[model samples]
Target: MRRMLTVCAAVAVAGTVVAAPAMAVAGGEAAGSGAAPWMVTVAFKGDEPLVQRESCGGALIAPDRVATAAHCLDHVDPTHLEVHVGGGTLSEDPGKVVPIKGWSVEPGFRLIPSPVDPQDFEKSSAADDVAVIKLARSVFGVPTLPVARTAPAPGSTVDLFGHGLTQAPDPKNPAAALGDQLKHAQLKVLDDGACAAGLASPGLLDGKSVLCTQGAATVCPGDSGGPLVQNGRLVGIVSFGGETAGKQCGEPTVDGFADAAVARSFLTQPRPPLAPMAAADPVITGTKAAGDTLTCEAPKWTIKPEKTEYAWYYNKVDPANGFEFYLPVEGATTPTLKVTDELAGHKLNCGITASTAGGTILQYSDVF
Candidate 1:
């Protein structure tokens, strides 16, 4: 049976229009265990070093890629975007800062009016609110999360993470705003029909590409683009949240997530070849001395490979002629190769080709 759906841009208010900021997790606790290594804090570059502002949250799905909300970078310049990984708070030096090189937003993405009014909900669509950012250099040593191929079953429990506000906004006190510390909460996925019914605008839930959650925990401004993980995989990106009768953040209301499966292909695209010792470059580990055993280590990839092939090449030494010649090393097909005395004076290099669901990538190690 086909389902009827409605659309919304941000939190809906009766008469006032409030522009939604990057959201956060309300009714949640501080993230102390550092459970989410892929969680990143997105901020604007300031004039001084280590100075950043206008923060948002994102997920590191690849060594050089971050998944976020399209609205977060809609009007911002790419050069001004700075990403901080492996941190629970903005003040912590969990990881180094990397500048954004480029980004791609879903073609179907459209901005919802700021301070969205109740009537605006009838005109906006949140189905394609996702985007991916390409970093100037790869992020190494930290773990990257994977996007779910399928949606989690309704009623399943999911974990939401963000560096947003702990309390609802208070108009009387401007200081009562969003949080800077990363927080998380557990939320239960809601059925499409029930999610739609809970909203003031009944047609706001797009069943296929968007889903909602229930319970005391909900996402608020500053949490946009954060990950909704289920069964240890990212299943959604925080898109928007519904308001309660009193126009507060919490239960009887639902928060929306852009279905990860709908944008998995774009999020996991293979990156360009990296420089030596960079994130995705193959490593040749072992001593260069004769008779020593050498092994080729495959570069870490966003997507695991189905198969891998290795080839060893020798740059033969020519005493009389200055010209260099590269000759294939016989019987060195696997990842490991033996260093022979006959090739002691020759330069040695290894080529590794990895085949993944996304595509193929070839990388070479430095000569030993």
Candidate 2:
């Protein structure tokens, strides 16, 4: 049996609503004066008519790359996917129409099985849902947005922009349709536990790879593949939404997003290498006078080490002796070594060992 998955698109069908949120970029207003320039309206190019068919929303992350939802273009041909940027609305003419030269989908994304269980729907939607489209030629004049490497903390607010419907469909009037104006909404990031609880699914939300938003505003149909901006950075892509009991848009419990950090590898070219760890030797601090406490100061490192060890030793025989011997101080595993009366005339020192992924570094402090 085919399983059903809920996707956040504007298209409507009979029996089931394709699992997308409701119309009018529901609960949002016109993006207005401060609209993002990187916003783009995605559509299909037909053979019969050279017209651009608007489908979803996307953000330009590079001169020739756009980031969107995997589900938006999963079934469509890459050559037919057209990207229109610097537009006020889908109905109005955008600055330029760029043809997609190539595209890539998150490797882990999979189709939801038909007749899917309600409990498992969220898990299916939360999986890799990101995609990147490379344009046929480099786009100039329009500024590209940067992708955020980390997700915003829960309770943080984000702005969503799309060319989806401006109002929810009237249930009584089944003929009501979505709008073509670019709209935007402010939504708060919900805690993973809270989002999962609201959806009645446990362990279904992955905080690192998925973002859940809850509030009066959310993405609706035609809003799929839109950009979720936090601090002016592209942190997520609109993916799916949970339906209400009425099976209509508006007042959704939570809307889902494909995390941009998880999709970073696909959006950028020539990925940078990881830096090596630089660790310094430990130093001895505090008064070294007899009967006073002498402390071993751990060295500062460029990268934090996983583990650290400290060892204290004291000279047990006179240095004048050709065979002077040093012995480990019992119960002195810590960084602090107390100078007792018995060790009044003995030389004391500390040895430090720091371990990291690169390798282990060992150093010793001067005798006190």
Best by lDDT: 1
Which structure among the candidates has the greatest TM-score? 1
The digit string of per-residue lDDT tens for model 2 on 1-368 reads 01111122333334433222444343456677437889877776655221225577889998888888877765343434578887775545464788665565566665442123544433345467777777769899888989998887899988888765443555664234344456677888888887767653444465566788877665556677889999889998887765422233444557778888877876675422111123445677877566788889976655455777789888875668767767888988889988788776777889866554323445677787
Residue-level lDDT tens digits of model 1 in 1-368: 00011112223333322222434333445666567888877776776423136356788988889988766655343544678887665655435677766665665555443233544543343666777888879898888888899988888998888765444445664333445456777888888888877665555566767878866566655677888898778898887764322344332357778888888876776753221222456788998778988898876654455767899989965789878878889989988888889766678889876553323345678787
Candidate 1: list runs displaced more than 4 Å: 1-27, 47-52, 111-125, 171-176, 243-246, 250-252, 271-368
Off by over 4 Å in 2: 1-27, 46-52, 111-124, 168-176, 243-246, 270-368
lDDT value, candidate 2, whole model:
0.64
The clash count of every prediction, one per candidate, is: 18, 13
- Scored by CA lDDT, what does every candidate get? 0.65, 0.64
Residue 293 of candidate 1: its Cα lDDT? 83
